[model samples]
Target: APDSGGGSSEDSFTEDSSTDVATEDASTLIPPPQLGLYGTLNQLQVDVSRLPRPDEYNPAMSSVEDFQTIDIPSDIKTVAYYLQAAQILPPGEDEIRFSRQEDQLAGGLVRRELDRSIARYAAESGDTATLTMTGEVLAPEVTSLEFYYFDGLAWVTQWDSEMLKGLPQAVRVVITIRPARSANRPEMIGLTNSMTAIEQGDLVYSLVVQLPLAEPPETMGDSAMEAMGL
Candidate 1:
């Protein structure tokens, strides 16, 4: 790690060799994601234009400035940026190729955001959930990123959109983050997430995201909207 690289961070990530990765016995030697230092969270500045262009949406508005700065919570730990993808036309020629449309096949009306919970369900099945969850506490870059659904009744830690045929009115995203140990760490290693629950620092952050009503078009079938609880 660089001498100036030290902030609040965990140990330096290793450049894993093919031989080392292939050896099961050597895997335990590597430590899970851990917090390095504890300090105030710094403000973040974002460049609007430099961000990746979304699949949809028009660039109707022109930027007066290139970048914008914003203040963040000083006690915060980490941040995870996510994008939900949808396209009118998916890859390749449209028809005769097994219905490769995101809306028709995935059915945004019936399975909003492709039932993001399926991946979580798979991860949290049986004893495996123990492996993924940091359990009673959250650790920087170590705890499982959890989503809680606030159904009309109460907030639930889990949801199956496929089984329910739709999604909740709102969602609560909870997770922790660790700062990059080195400047190049992000490009080289990406954000490190633990496969197993880490018992270390307890740092968590949550934000409530109220979902827009998934209103179907007038021509859309009544069955789907009803299933969606709209």
Candidate 2:
């Protein structure tokens, strides 16, 4: 009488065994690795020591010393004084401008023709003029990366072959002022100066890097437990 239903007991044991096996299988599965993008900008210190000094000279003046006695008109003289002032401005003050976004950036430099102004003043006493400015920009980006600059009229293509990721990059921008072609007819040139009256151009740059998502320690612990069938 006690064994009459023994078959049912065996079936119950089989079902229980199957349920345990399913639980063990679920515990052993590993999770997939996660991936993501990380973006950052690092400010880089610029050393102007290595930059070449403004070398353009006025053919009308024998030497920079002549600038002291030049009989420049009052208006032209004013421009000359301001041009010299631009040079002593604070770092990243009147000389450079920077713009940044999530995936794009831009920089500009302001250049003034100090040499031309001084030279012109030395040549003429009744002439009024403004200094000419041209920008020579040099910025770095990841290799095969493309960027653009406002060319007074529109954005122009700026591309480079330097690739950068997950690390800071340094870009050196050099701005120079050269003589204007016509005397007493100086026109505004180069990047517009936002911080000063001096004509400006830009060579702005920064380092950008991509970083992997940080994996939590608990995630690894759980993965290991599952792998060990714990």
Candidate 3:
């Protein structure tokens, strides 16, 4: 799939177009494409053994449990894998199943190859980085996840990606900053809560956030917050 290249359409307008035209401009008038409510949810599963601790279960929700949403670049394939597992697997077959032992082995090898590819590209591009934040929310109703970083004066924009279809209500947010090393530094980070609620189907909420490129000052981080009783 191709990225939609997200941004507000307002920037495309030219003041010259406001002039009264002699004839109806066919070029100016065009119809929008048919679109659906949700985009595909890519999934990335964490190996429990590799993880120091397992994710906690959510008691309040049943159908979906605690999950996080992370901000990652759209180009990386691993990001797609993560989105696929968390967002797509559950509904399709309850889980992602390897047909045979050989298949499983092949899948593992493929995964490693993909990881190496991502790392290589990151080294060369220096335009992306990854941050794994804990926790997950129900498939968010937001149109997109935007990564905001704190500047000295105000929160500045870092990155954003469109949410995929079947995004889990709850999924761990493992932000994968592309290029691992990048010129644009991150100062602080947070998620955006800007999403509309679906009137009919499943309730959706977004986890758009702003995160820091560098470690935040003494006032931030979990341990600091704990000390401050935040």
Candidate 4:
């Protein structure tokens, strides 16, 4: 599936859009409906890998600094295999069978790739990276599972899957990032959350990852040698 370029749009997750969240004052004035117990997964693993390297180095674009992993809580039982774009039914549309063919409203629909230029650069450089997640579901009958990305302001659903057989199932999700070719060093720090629905409540798991810029190596200079008293 093609990637959604990096930019702010009406449906984009932005800082200004986050202000629309439900506030305590507003909630007190009008109590919100109970949406079951809201919980989060205990643990999640993030693996980032570099594709291949190009013959020529481009300092203008962002490179794969490193791959970092996050260990979260393991209370909720669920697993995600691959992470990518998914199609969901449009608002106001009636939900059908849990099967992908039956329920998917569209496909190749993703909020945004982590670093747009990464993929482009990787492809051009003949090197790329991928992100995948796996977990288990503890609930007896899990109705559905949804994955989202936080773009500074809000969480946007990137993949949604309906578990037809329900519960004690394994989940997998995947997404790929290539080397960035642009000079624009956009912030790669972001948060990802997953919502799993069960009979009791929803399990919401959040993980944070920051793609730092590669630090340049320091070359020996006369000032450095003097400071060291060499």
Candidate 5:
């Protein structure tokens, strides 16, 4: 659909309003929207982001702390091709997708693109040169972000429609923001645990998104059919 803008982004994944998520329940909280997710390119700021075009799932989760590159499955069995620029855009045009760091070579350009993406986010929220450490600026104030998939059973750390043979029944994401560290008390911060973040005055937001469980469309590509063992 659309991509997150450098420096101007803030965990705009689907858009959430309240920054103080500690009071919000565990349910996936919906934001009011700032960046247009679909084809709302060219605008640095939007009061609310538009929804993705039906049949288009090029998803990205850019926000305050982490900026990952876009990952669109090539031979997916479930999702209908979720990537950008080369696939989503008209031939020869480039586009940004919401994402994070590491394994950036998504859709063949994940790592490099994500580096640039995170660089943009880090420049605004944090700093790209700094690792996930205390005092190291991540995106704005966001220090870490993570995504999970629920396949009607247990929660998983990662999800690939190609491997699962269908879309996830629900998705869970955790975004951690480092509250301004105290000048008098400087400490090291690592992006490995949410509880640790909470103990250190960091704000951790958890969102569980439930998706409709629909049968795959009848129009399956040969690769998708093969992956599904059709």
Candidate 6:
């Protein structure tokens, strides 16, 4: 019989080799690790531009010099600005009697300039109801932008003229969004929404946004308006 003192050299060697193979196989079975710092910092880029043109009926107007300003991150998923008929005082001779001259007389003047453009855009895709943006929000270097509506109770959602048919809510709202700034991190900015639910006819706005990251957003200045001769 073989010596019973201890295990053979060949047997020990085999056992060690088995353990090493099992360790390597086990490591291979594990999934790849998730992205960490690199994922956290890098982001996709997007641009947003959804404001009414200067020569249009901007019911959101509060005063002669008052214009809506929407701030967005250079990297933005979406942005929306809303204007409602309720923002304007009640329509009637009496309402006008108490309103400022510059505000009262300018309504039809602005609508005339925008009526055709609004109609054309609405008819472009064989859709009904219409919302058109007159100002440029994207810089010359950027392309690819999307539009949406600013709902009082929800995040931005896809919008079309058909979705607004026959309702005549007289609530005119516009929104814009871009892709995420990075794989995981989205840019964020403030959305200013001012409208009246019912009476008082005063503008009420809220500013809150979460999106992908990018350059700081800025307002479309008077120069942009003058360029269009608004």
CA-lDDT, candidates in order: 0.28, 0.21, 0.22, 0.23, 0.33, 0.22
TM-score of each: 0.26, 0.15, 0.21, 0.18, 0.35, 0.17
lDDT of 4 at 112: 17
Candidate 2 vs 4: which has more lDDT = 4
Candidate 6 off by > 4 Å: 1-114, 117-138, 160-230
**Candidate 5 C-alpha lDDT tens digits along 160-220:** 4444555655555455556667788543323334544555566677655555552445554
Among these predicted structures, which one has the highest lDDT? 5
Error of 5 at 207 (Å): 1.1
RMSD of model 4 against the true structure: 23.2
Please give the lDDT score for candidate 3.
0.22
lDDT of 2 at 184: 54
Tens digit of lDDT per residue, candidate 6, span 119-146? 2343454332112121122221111111
- Residue-level lDDT of model 4, residues 1-230, one tens digit each, is 32232322112222222212111110111111221111112112222234423521332332212211112222221222222222333476333222223212222112212232332333344322122111111221211223233222233333121211111112122121223325754312111222101111223222233223212124535653342222
- Best-to-worst order by TM-score is 5, 1, 3, 4, 6, 2
Query: What TM-score, to 2 decimals, does candidate 6 have?
Result: 0.17
Specify the poorest-scoring 10-residue window by lDDT in model 4.
23-32
Error of 2 at 126 (Å): 41
Tens digits of lDDT, candidate 2, 66-122: 222332222221111011112122355422221112121122221112223443443
Off by over 4 Å in 3: 1-143, 159-230
Total clashes for model 6: 17
lDDT string for model 1 (123-204, tens) is 3443232111111111223222334455554455444444444555555543434434467443211122221112223343
Residue 38 local lDDT, model 4: 18
lDDT of 1 at 51: 30
Predicted structure 2, TM vs. truth: 0.15
2 versus 3: better lDDT goes to: 3
